[model samples]
Target: MTRTPRGEAPDVGVPAHLAEHMTVAEQHDWIAGFLRRHPVSRRSALRRGSGVVAAMGLASAPWTLAACASAASAPVSVVGRHLSFGDDPLRSMAMAGELTAPPQGRVVVDLGQNGSFGATLPVEVRRLVSQVPQADGSIRASDQYFVHALATGLQPGQGYDYRFRLADGTTTDTATFHTAPRQPTSPWSFTAFADQGVDMVPPSGLSGFTNAYYKPDDTRRTMTPSTSMVDRIAATRPAFHLLAGDICYADPSGEGEPVKSTGTSKSPSGFDSFDPTVWTTYFGLIERSAASTPWMFATGNHDMEALYDDNTARGALHGYGGHAARLDLPRTGPSACPSVYSMRYGNVGVISVDANDLSMEIPTNAGYSGGSQVAWLRQTLLQWRAAGSGIDFVVAFFHHCAYATSSTHASDAGVRAAVAPLFDEFSVDLALQGHNHQYERSNPIRAGRSTTQVPDGGTARPETDGTTYVCVGSGGRPRYSWQPGEVDRYRGNPAPQGDVNVVSYQAVGASAKVPDAVDWSQARYLDYAYVTVDVVPPPGPGQVTTMTLRTITDTGVEIDRVTLERRAR
Candidate 1:
């Protein structure tokens, strides 16, 4: 609540005179503390990177000053700082993010071994154009580009020092990253969630929808210091972060606009549509964690830009113009379905499938790549199961739920009809889903029956048979409820639900009903939570691998835990 004298740089949240005498590290820490305590509107000191870089003495080198200066007008809103090596077969990474203009010059990637630069990779840059409908019925156009530096041949389980070199021969600060392990000899964990909002400060006169479920009181209590779920995830320090979808909710209305009731269906309040600012806010929110971790993505329904109802008008685009521009998903799946891809880390093989291709809920891409995606899925699973495949478990994650019972957007019948059989046939160890806005897991199910009942904090051997389906949609969005009072995991008996879990009918009542005593429901929680899966490898290869799935609250509370064991066939 005080103003610094004009013409002199503000002390970056420290006493002005003391800041002048502080070390680079001290200044960096001071700036970080300032950002944490004060509103971002006071970030003019760090806005263009000049003041902050100077404050840290990082711009002392002439080349460094040149590189930082280029970004001043580069329109680089936020760097998609994370990698997705876990989702790419070659373990190559596409370092991409949203930008307002096409980037110039090549980027030099220095992969350091130990403390020295082991290899330098130079890649060309390219751009993807996006045209989105704005709130005022105008088109907001922008270009996003990848660094073109595809980092390959990285040794798994090895940590490397890396940095970037701009076109002007300027090098950036060194950052450290660890590659996913090819074989885990011990327990390894990764964080996962969906529906995380950017927490944007809306434009003047525009506000977000009031979330009825994740009330202000609950958010006030659970939100961390940065007021971000990413902060909590970073605290766990998982190998990677799996974003199940709806990364920013940069839709027409955003997170604050209330849903507009329109007949049987409802839409968001039309305040803004695909404004790049949403992504700007999103990248800033996760920069703390994503900059180092491989934050992989699975396309959710909201990620697409589908404003029209006519299916034919949408064409084969599937509403990923903006997404394709900003993010670089693996192109290993069917050419028609860029969202479908697979990768492996340790003994675990993960397949990110796009349900929009066959989704009855959002039919923009219905049947476009249905056959191809299925064929790819079968082949991918078969390859992972082949002799010497090294893969002990296969995890398939997508947006829609195949066996969720949340009060909103229950298990999609279309998903079950198309994808469920393949899961059983391939003996997938796990199926992760979102869109339900709650946390729920099913028993080890095969052919609509429970193959094994896994209690809370229990373990199951999915490698021998059956698959466990889990929903980790409660990342940061409003929580959904369960229809019944209490759906027991072991038995079909109805009991009173606990305080953490709520009961609501407006969302999943009619669609979530299961025939016969549906005892397949396992652990269920209705809160803003995420799932951390720990994949534990055996002492040696060709042995049993275990995956412990823990559903944790944003505030770091472990509510439910399930361990799954699998072995390579």
Candidate 2:
């Protein structure tokens, strides 16, 4: 309740005499405790990063001189720390976070066993933040110094505590995360969702119908239901999470081009509403989970960020330069596209596909890979399925639904044509998709045709029944209505009645939405939702392996449940 002292360095509620006597780690802890007592609005922090230091007369105050030193000379505090799975989920992992200021000394990441550091790895920091002062005198820090750290030589399927190590052995608070097991018999789980963004932060461009009507109160620890869902996911204790894309709607227009306007990012519009701070807010919000869990993200149309076209030569990067710096996705084929990659955890083989490369609906960044992604995908699947590969299930996730029934974006024939055939040929167990803002599942299909009706509770054998496609796009955005003449995912209390026909479409060259009739929509729910998959590895080879999937809503209801089973090799 106390205000910052005027014409003085912010005390951080600590006496300077005592702070100077305390250790650097203790000083950092004191600052963090100060933040807990006196909260700072995210908006003000983004706009006034340096205002506090300047207005507080830090340089004039000898008590604050050491803290006010440049980050290049001293270790700077960081925000939005997160992790991702590298090429090897067991032995290696990727760590990323952002810093407002530059770093001069090596930023070390300590992998802790018990309470002590077992291994220390240094990180590479890149200056990717560009500030464009708005007419309102507020700086739009769309980016900042991103710290990318990789840790290896870890024991498979083990839990380790990690923290950022600053100069003089000072460290951030520790968080625990688990790696994947190395054997097929190891059981594990994961969480998934898409289209989720920061809730109700209009300045960050997270205006869900202007008031975040989709958010519901769950735990009092967080303000947004998205964060609550993240906590719930962490409760499930997943080894890793799969975010199908549309990660953060920083550029809500999804048109690839986000231009500044007289009435800017605070309000939602067809165009001219781009605020880069939304990424900061979203990342800060997800730190609870992303800091401890590996959130593997795929590419979506909304993510085709064209906001950072700083260099015309690499304009094809499509704001992806920013993404690459923040989320170090593991890629095999090309550096040009960072979203396409493959990872393995125990008996499951996971892949992240960049649907932006194959989308016809949002074609701005389409074809950037020139068919290489598909080729690499084919090779990866083949290698995973080779004789004695030890892989039992292969799951692929991406944005741009290939078999959805939403009226907004029913199905991208381009996505279906490119990946569906490959998935079918390679016996992909599941294809998770997003960008539609609802949840819809499909029957097992092969060669673009539904093989048989696998009901909600039916067990699907992908090796024979075909691949099952699911659109868990209901991460945390506004709910979407089903296509006209089609029923909801399933019958509800009153039930959504229609002509009982699935009207679908494939976008054609940005000029039209080609229509067709289909009947693959299994269960539909127009609400904020997420998914959790419990992977049950086989006891031994030639045994039954199961993946029990539970589709849960924001209201804490299990609307649909399904199982994917196959024999272990």
Candidate 3:
């Protein structure tokens, strides 16, 4: 079971006939062809081919009925439709402000202020186009819609009120955002989470794992879906929001099931094809928090859904074009994947990498970053640690966990073998990850193993300690159960198999090895939660900078909390 570029499990299971030498694209095509030639007929098989027509709202006319019937008889493209971020001018008219990197004179750059783009008065607003993949493997361009952003300039620790100008020249309600303090002495805070896109289907009465669609009522809301978990995060009013990936499950719908459309009537089955409007809905859900703070994103596997071609989506690593065009992110790393970049807020230097390039779990765009990215990461960390860099704490975040213990998705060996060593060498304070759908934290780890356990609410000095890796993937997705005997093992059980120190596999068959248990795993929780890191200043000069990290469930419960300190260089 080879991995994909996104560092998750391979999209499709192993084939009956091993095609070890085939490229991912070749394998993908071969599987599709095989499935077509030998179609698997099921109860809802009638709508398998023609679901796309009804999903696109083309089933309204009488003549379309004939077309739909004919389509239902043939093999239909099950790839779904999406709504445009700029579909409505009025909807797009809201602006969120973020501070620039250089501590400029009241300037607001893109997310994390990693780039330089001068802001002038009387900014011109124009319509933005969002691209969608069609059923026939073609690109469908949405109508252009515009949003006007007003930059009032900015000041350290200052709250600025702003409004968005609609395409028709109307203005949106005022929203306010606060800038981070200019110096490292000032304390700051931020939030991080991943995999919060809600795509549940209406339940069908059945039994077993394939029985019912897991659609919760809140997931189907028109606005501010509960699954978004943005409301609670907004209440904290963090300096920015770090989305590690799978922000929207806009990929194929039904979670590894065939596309089935119930009828042209009411709501489609919970297991319907993809819906592009999920993007529109997702943005609305996250608006409150994002509009108030910088919302930085790292592309996950789901974000790389280039239905027509790899580059169709936006951001680095063959990401979604629409997702990239919608946000104002820093363009510092390789131009091919702008999502990989660095930023500084107070004493924290945040570096985001594109794991899709090296991920064997999602091979759609494997080798996209090549070796240049890891080289860049090494250099970025070295620069931050240098004198006069003003970065006291180095935090790196991306999709795919380097060290995690969830039964649903284990640690990505590629990430651990390639990236973890660099992080340890650079004395990175914290490594944040998602895609496991659970919350797990590791002790300060060096050389692929933990030297000692960092207790909950404990403080670790990075200068002498290794890097701490945390998986905060429970941002509103269904929780993944832990490995067997995880509870007893995490509670200091000494048995080998029952120990929680291992990053087990979801891979099938033999030839898999159970490496020595990872003594670094200190905490594990199976709940829907997010992490908030508060950067606190040291009490004296030459002292360490401290960061308080807390994992809070959606219900406001603090599940796990820890503090990390980085001594002055």
TM-score winner among the candidates? 2
lDDT of 2: 0.67
lDDT of 3 by residue, 448-527 (tens): 77867677777887777888898878776656677765752222224342433664652221123344366777877665
lDDT of 2 by residue, 458-549 (tens): 78888998898999898876666676556655434266434324767776544457886766666777766788898998888788999988
Model 2, poorest ten-residue lDDT window?
1-10
Q: Clash number for every model?
A: 7, 2, 26
- How close is every model to the real structure, measured as TM-score? 0.74, 0.80, 0.72
Error of 1 at 398 (Å): 0.6
Model 1 residue 187 CA deviation in Å? 2.3
Better of 2 and 3 by TM-score: 2
Ranking by TM-score: 2, 1, 3
Off by over 4 Å in 1: 1-80, 86-91, 97-106, 128-130, 133-137, 142-146, 168-171, 202-213, 216-221, 224-227, 252-272, 306-316, 484-517, 567-569
